[model samples]
Target: MPKPTPETLARMKDVVGPKGFVDDAAEMAPYLVERRELYVGRAAAVLKPATTAEVSAILRIAHETGTAIVPQGGNTGLVGGQIPSGTGEEVVLSLSRMNRVRALDAGNNTLALDAGVTLAAAQTAAEEAGRLFPLSLASEGTCQIGGNLSTNAGGTAVLRYGNARDLVLGLEVVTASGEVWDGMRGLRKDNTGYDLKQLFLGSEGTLGIITGAVLKLFPRPQSLATAFAAVPDVASAVKLLRVADAVSGGMVTAFELVPRIGLEFVVSHVEGASDPLPDVSPWYVLIEMSAGSATAGLDETLEAVLAEGLEQALLSDAVLARSEAQRADFWRLRETLSEVQRLEGGSIKHDVSVPVSAMGAFIARATAEVTRAMPGVRVVAFGHIGDGNVHFNLSQPAGADKAAFLARWGEMNALVHGIVREMGGSISAEHGVGQLKRDEIAATKARVEIETMRALKRALDPKGILNPGKVV
Candidate 1:
């Protein structure tokens, strides 16, 4: 619990070379801060280990010295799961140097990759082997696999592929006591025991540091069809989703809902972005369908679905992309929403989920409550409606003081998350319970749930030296 001593620092430097251990404030500044700029912290040193054995050795030293270790990946996490917590007593264990693709078994449909590999790189490696790694995220180009697994990220493809937890087959983790637990099996059905890998999948590095993993792969889709349809509201979007699911028979990969305000923000702020449809409506649903076979009727199927939706009054207007370039352009508008909002002004963001049946009610009720709480606030609501997850974000009114608006984050979060809980939803859907949501977890979760999580943490990490003060 005490601050690390000079002797401890010297020992850490010895475990990893001088170049591997960084203590200079200038050198450690980036690792000290988080992506959201919400959680700022200090670290005694940032240790970069090149291999799993090196990570184990560094962890052993930290464990023996009773020094807290915060495992960091690409530092692209929205929550403060990667940065130190300003205690200035902990050391950041950086996995950037551990980046490597160990194996790609096409026959087994799995890729054994180091935890430090970027999500995009892993996807590319899978593609080279004529397979698909379907865990797609907006931050795929920068976020590491370890952070993705720690957070159990859900991106656009989750409707068909599931979340990051589903894509993982096995994990190689270093526990708090510096013992490596190797469970990297590529088996599809191994009901041999307790399935311990699930414990660390979304633990946010609290129980242990995941060094590498065996990830599942799927057959690459040979054709993709994208469309943008304007719905009367969230309810209509939900109805259309049900129809699409039934029509496509599980080929509906993504179903995103965007508000008019969200699209306006993207068009106005993001360069080279334009409206996907000829006329805009109050709400829009971006749908994507893919098939592994070389099928030419995907476009025809999408068009038929849209025509039926129009006839049923489930959609107000729709546009189906005729070419691949046009399809990419349509998706670019949806992908650039978050960045455009950031460029516009200070925004309060929430990544929450509810039951599919309650999603429409949650969105409508939360929008009304939040607008009432802060008049003139621009509600930029959009996200994976098919999975009941919404990025219900709110931007301050133009010309409003940024500091003052951001100061009300807690109030806004309470208003939105309260509705989510009432609808039997989660406060943090894909993002894990990092430092940002620790207190929120205490407030929102049942006593038994919190107590059970704490018990698991205590059982796996008795000394509590691994990523201390995170999650439970």
Candidate 2:
């Protein structure tokens, strides 16, 4: 494809009004830098289209000119997916202004929202209608629904609600040729020829730009019980997770694992954060249970499970939040973990997943390997253990040179991702194969899988104009 020229820029400005476009270096600074500060790049312009028609027009112009366009959401992606590439020839197509909740069907428990709607906003809309949109995330307040769908995000709720892909019923997308495919149906069962929505859910804007979507909703939970328990180690956490899953019988909403080091960092760096348990253990698991009926004994169920875990020696200590405020406080500690790590120093983070049965082994092996690779490195491992996804991150040693430590990102990623691949795992679990992991995916994924993805990309976007340089 040819580079974006002055003429193309002028045409783009005309397509998207003056207020919808920006080329100033200062104005584009925030969009250039990624959430993790790991990747940075320049863009020709950042175009904010307020409507899907405007998006279509801008994409049409770019398609005709053979200009690469990067689809950007709230710019809160962890893997630098929303940031432009280093070519400096791409234009960022921001969807922030396209935020809108188009329709809601309470009886059907479905919602149709524009791509720019924030995850938090969607959740609020669901709650107002007495339904639940169970795709919760740490960045729910800032991340757009489009980015979440693009990444196929999985949060603590994934243990019960499944990933973002499962929550989406239909999608309206703009293909590389600027043609909109309206597949927005709220049907629960449609034995069609093929499930095309699945192709775009986690495509990371590679084949097309998702403009709107119809998402599934569930009955709102009337009672919720949250507890924080200290465990002996990763193995014990895994055992407790199984116990909870079995005892709750699908009532278990979330099961998050947090290392002692992670809690220490949160307590020290995040304000008003304190340890959940009176005594600290090597690791902690935040367990949550929810039920739709008001009379459901969620608290009693969780209490009974905790009692059994304690009796069986699977849990070392436990603390159940007594009130809603206390429950929020407990969650605040887990949510602030990434931020606290950022305050500590430069860190190498990995979002990888393996089978639930192999999670304990993966954690042990990865920790040992990372320590051997870089002596004195502090590993801060934590994530949703129930779903087999762990953020096995590493913090630089105290007083170590930040630049030197960060320079080893590739080495660290190789050591960690190699173990994930060997154990039948994914290098980019929920973050999607954005630019950060595009090359790594190409290197690690099976030839057949990669070829299949490339074939789909060609079939949907033969000209390679839709979010170029992303995914396959």
Candidate 3:
């Protein structure tokens, strides 16, 4: 698509008024880049719409002018989905100004909020209502609910509450044609017709811009238990997860896999991080369980599972958090692993998922193949093993040139993704197919799937002015 004309840009800017947009290069810098700095883009302007009507107006102008509009939120996306392209012709539609808690229905266990509401803020709202919004992430403080829905984000709680799509009951979307589709019903069962909300959930802003959402909530957990266990290996960790599920009667909220190297990175680099267990193990798992009632005996349940794991040799050692502070400290270790990897040097990261049954094999085989291809490379494979999503990262070989190591990103991707394909895995799991893995998706997915995605994109965004050059 051609760049949006300056005249059209100014007209679009007027839709949101003066405070609604940013044109200065300095002011737009933050919106033009992503968290990893993997992709730096340029935009004609950054439009911050405060309301859904303003978003609709901006889209109308962009559609008429054939101008690309990249909808961005929080700017914390690992993939480049939220960032504009390098053409500098695209306009960024940021939802930051729309941050508002529309309503919280404690009786229905639902929340209606503008898309710009931060995840942390949403959680707080639910908490104040005596309910729980289970969708969470390491960037909860900054990542917006709209971006979470666009990317269908998966985090620690996904194993229990499901992905962002599952948590959302409905969406308020502004289509590429600048038409609003208000399907914001908070009903538990709405089989009236096509579930249109699913289409926009993970579309990554290509089909439409998510303006607001009606999210499902749950009873706030009255009892919570967290444990850090040292497993013998990946296989053992997988086995222990099943055991924990059975013993806890399906109370396993989050079961994360942590490689020895990743743990070492966190404890060594992250402040206030220490090994919970005394004895070292090759692999570890962070297991968390929650109960709705205070007398649910979650701690006892967790202890029983750990005891069985020990008896079966699934785990070598375990440490259960005794207090809320200790629980936070334990989580601090896991959450900081991703950021601390940078201190180790250049890292090639892959967020992929296989069937839970194949996670153990997939990690083992991929680690072996990557190591064989690049000797001395440190493999830091870790993530929500409960749902099979693994953030398989490769730290540059010790003392190796950072740029030279990063240059092989594609080579390593192919090497690792090859194993993923053989194991029937997804190339882009929780992280949506932004520019990073957009092309790779075609090669990995069946032709019918790609064609269908393109068909939807064309139908909703005929002008292709919405998040062009990303996703399908």
Q: What is the TM-score of each candidate against the true structure?
A: 0.98, 0.98, 0.99
Q: Write model 3 residue lDDT over 1-472, tens digit each, in one string.
A: 7787879878987888999879999999999988889999999899999999999989888888788899999999988999998889899999999999999999999999999999999999999989999988999999999999999999999889999999999899999989999989999898898899999999999999999999999999999999999998888999999999899989999999998999999999987788898888999999999999999999999999999999999999999999999999889888999999999999999999999999888988888899999999999999999999999999999999999999999999999888888888888889898999989997778999999999999999999999988998
Please identify which of the two predictions, 1 or 2, would achieve the higher lDDT against the true structure: 2
Q: Which stretches of model 2 miss by more than 4 angstroms?
A: none
What is candidate 3's TM-score against the reference?
0.99
Regions of candidate 1 where Cα sits further than 4 Å from its true position: none
For model 3, name the residue pairs that clash. none
Per-residue lDDT, model 2, residue 246, is 84
Alpha-carbon RMSD to native, per candidate: 1.1, 1.1, 0.8
Ranking by lDDT: 3, 2, 1
Weakest lDDT window of 10 consecutive positions for candidate 1: 293-302
- The residue pairs that clash in candidate 1, if any, are none
Candidate 3 Cα errors over 4 Å, as ranges: none
lDDT of 1 by residue, 367-467 (tens): 99998999999998899998999999999988899999999999999899989888889999887778888888987789999999999989988878888
Clashes of each: 0, 0, 0
TM-score of 1: 0.98
**Minimal lDDT window, size 10, model 2:** 463-472
